[model samples]
Target: MTMATYKQIESLMGTGPPAGAKQMQVMRWASKNPPKDPNASFSGKNVLITGSNTGIGLQAAIKFAALDAAKVILAVRSPAKGEEAKQKIIAATKRESAAVIVMQLDMSSFESVKTFAVQIQAQVDRLDVAVLNAGIAPPKYATEKTGWESALQVNVLSTALLAILLVPMLKDTAAKAGRPSQLTITGSFACQYVQPDELKLSPGEKLLEKMTSPEHFNVEKSYGQIKLLTQYVMKGLVDDYSYDVNGQVDVAIDVACPGYCSTDLGRDFPWYIALPTKLMHLYCARTAEEGSRSLVSGTLLGNAGHGKFWTNDVFTDPGIMVTSDEGKKLQRQAWKEISDICKQKMG
Candidate 1:
């Protein structure tokens, strides 16, 4: 593991869930107050959001459009649905049809992600904000065509790939706009719930390799673990590439947690799991629109939010795994593995 600076290590210490934090989060959810709509305007700015066809992504697209963004690109796996979502955003915002563009983006496939990136490069002049919100919570173990576990593939692998690919465009836009461009990746509080023992591995066994191995898959634990890996990727991006030649931030990269919103993310859950989750949603989950506020606010944080995790309208600790000694080692290992995969795939 690479040596992290003392400041970096200190930043993570004591930041995140204390003892019995998960229970406290659930209690807060029942009375969870929605974020006040940000007064910050995106007028004339172009924005893009993946998985915008449904859930918080769709709701977030509506918010961006209503805020007067020049263009709100809905990048989804299904164009037909993307178009439907476009209409919804337009109707909600009273924005013109031309204000929202639907683009195909299959997070399950690297080729598809690459194609989407190329399309963005070819068509858009400048992207002021991008929210990589496409992800899944599969109840059963499954692999995409890439042979990686579905959650790991979309939530961590392709997400890392897309973020890195979009950096140059974000940097270019920041230079022209005289403000840092925002690239917010959707993350979750679940990231903090994962325990070190849960991820115990054999000697020299790579964390990602073990997590993605079908023989070792654990549906109940996979989502949190994958989200944790996504946090690692976000940190790696900020540490390695977000700065300019003069050390000023070029792109403001950060993670946004939607706060366990009531969305279709659990639609595929087995009855056993789905029943409890639905009940929990009814009891405590935030509305999809309410959850989306974090994504919008996250993008507007500018340089102050770089490399930080934003949740519930404020920046907070990402959890112990992101700060502890053993966890930092895992963070380095996960970043090395994920970055290598992204580079190979991008090549």
Candidate 2:
């Protein structure tokens, strides 16, 4: 039998298959060849992370608390789980009075997202960094609480809605502070695996309905399609976030990937896929702590990071296909149509 490395497996089955090896090449490189130094503290900053109950988000909360952040809000589907995660973070960091708190946020629901944003506006004086990190990978037939496919609701629609709601808050904060505030959408390597055929539909009233139909359901392709659509939302709306409601550039908005990490995002994996995946997680996946470092580093970038896709602690091409001339044309066309749909659908 041929032994499987990350790349070898990807070559055989596009991005993820055999339900194991979720592309560890970037993470393996990041782990073995770590960065030169620790990026510095987030002291006095009010940082918020969605899905902070476990995995990379949990690690990020710990580090920000250790750095003496004024507030570390855990935005999660369950306040109970968020509180539990907060306790663990306090125990790990021993940062008593870190002001780490749990705020309920169900990313699959538009109502929940709006309420969370309003609560932020009411309570927090400033938001130094907002990390949009919650996401899901559903089984072929899974659906979110909102009735859309699980990947579509949790990963794209609700997440984008929350980002749009938070824009003014980030902008107002940037305007108040000399430095620009940050809004980072946790991105994925899945963005690299898309093809034009996957999104070749012309602008039409029913395009979203057509694309998301169960008839198009293919387990292997669903997750990547969600990530690709997410990138489009990031690219399409990032510019708007850069400028405030007054149209002055006061915030930095970008997407960041933590590479492949062992996380609960794959909670929906079937037993067969899940069993072998445990082995791959042990050998290939970056520990959540290691992955979280990449995400936290993104909040520290300057103007160079505006509207860019960041990974491995650097701003680099999200994909060849996403940046090519033809790609640019496609992105623009997709953005024009999708933006309108997103506004209408999200409303």
Candidate 3:
């Protein structure tokens, strides 16, 4: 068998079935119940969720509130919409009005993310759970003010910046509580389907630079590649940055994939793209509330889930592109490129 065929077989037998088989497995996934832990409690913990104004993020916020998190910070690009979400969570859970805080966080802008981090530093002493859930899948290619592609800026750079900036708080909280804190980034199952051919690179051409170029933009492909990079960033943080002064891991970093949820993530898709997605959603997609279970459950994993992927109430392999030798080399390159961008932006 060819190497590509071997990889596909390995994926099917051990890791997961290939993405072309996703439709066939949809019924199984849809029929499978989401997880619930009656004993799970976040009574005094502060849970922060970006993009909490709608969809899976909003549902996760509601779940956190219902579970009695002391504070649920809804960090969104729009404070007004966030307030509406807060009211909804309060009304649903009957939690105190003061338990939910709406904070502004514009992931498209690095400056906005920095200001929001400063506000977070001033507001809380210990952050127990932070879900970096904000992301975009624009059908059109665009660049943010930082001159990076829009998805690269929002989904990767800003996500990394916010995670690193919050590390001190996570570590401090973990040290005080004597348990590792949770840091879960919203990832996607699409990353698994990223073909090796799509990632072919010329010698000396950096992965991030090639992916972000306008000439090579394809929304679906880029989205998968970006999510693959998200996994890399999560792994890099777990391997290098999440330890405390004592050399023990103080924060658990993992990626949560809310499988094929019926969210507005493809709101801007062209007719050709949107139609098939709509059909798929009609037939197979989970509700936002159902999908949010992965996000809430992932935070409950703590240290066991560091550098792992959580979905459908189980820890599964991320993908071939995230696990193969070729992937390791590319992940190192991507991590370096992302860290450099983050350092410059943070400085």
Question: Which stretches of candidate 3 lie above 4 Å from their native place?
Answer: 1-23, 26-28, 35-39
Per-residue alpha-carbon lDDT of candidate 1 for residues 47-104, written as tens digits (9 for 90 to 100)? 9999999999999999999999999999999999998999888889899998999999
Report how far off residue 255 is in candidate 1 (Å): 0.6
Q: What is candidate 2's CA lDDT for residue 231?
A: 76
Model 3 shows how many backbone clashes? 0
Residue 286 lDDT (model 2): 75
Tens digits of lDDT, candidate 2, 117-167: 999888788888999989877766666666677678787778878887887
Instruction: Compare the candidates by TM-score and give the number of the best one.
Output: 1
Candidate 1 residues lying further than 4 Å off, grouped into runs, are 1-30
Could you give candidate 3's per-residue lDDT for residues 1-347 as a string of tens digits? 35653443233221233345564484345435443422367899999999999999999999999989999999999999999999999999999999999999999998998899899989877799999999999898999878889999899989998998888888889888888888999998888888788988999998878878998789768999899989999988887788877777789899988777889989989999999989888777888888887788778766667789976665777788899999888889888988888888788
Ranking according to TM-score, highest score first: 1, 3, 2
Please identify which of the two predictions, 1 or 2, would achieve the higher TM-score against the true structure: 1
TM-score of 1: 0.92
Clashing pairs for model 3 are: none
TM-score of 3: 0.91
Instruction: Quote the lDDT for 269 in model 3.
Output: 92
The per-prediction tally of clashing pairs is 0, 0, 0
Q: What is the TM-score of each candidate against the true structure?
A: 0.92, 0.85, 0.91
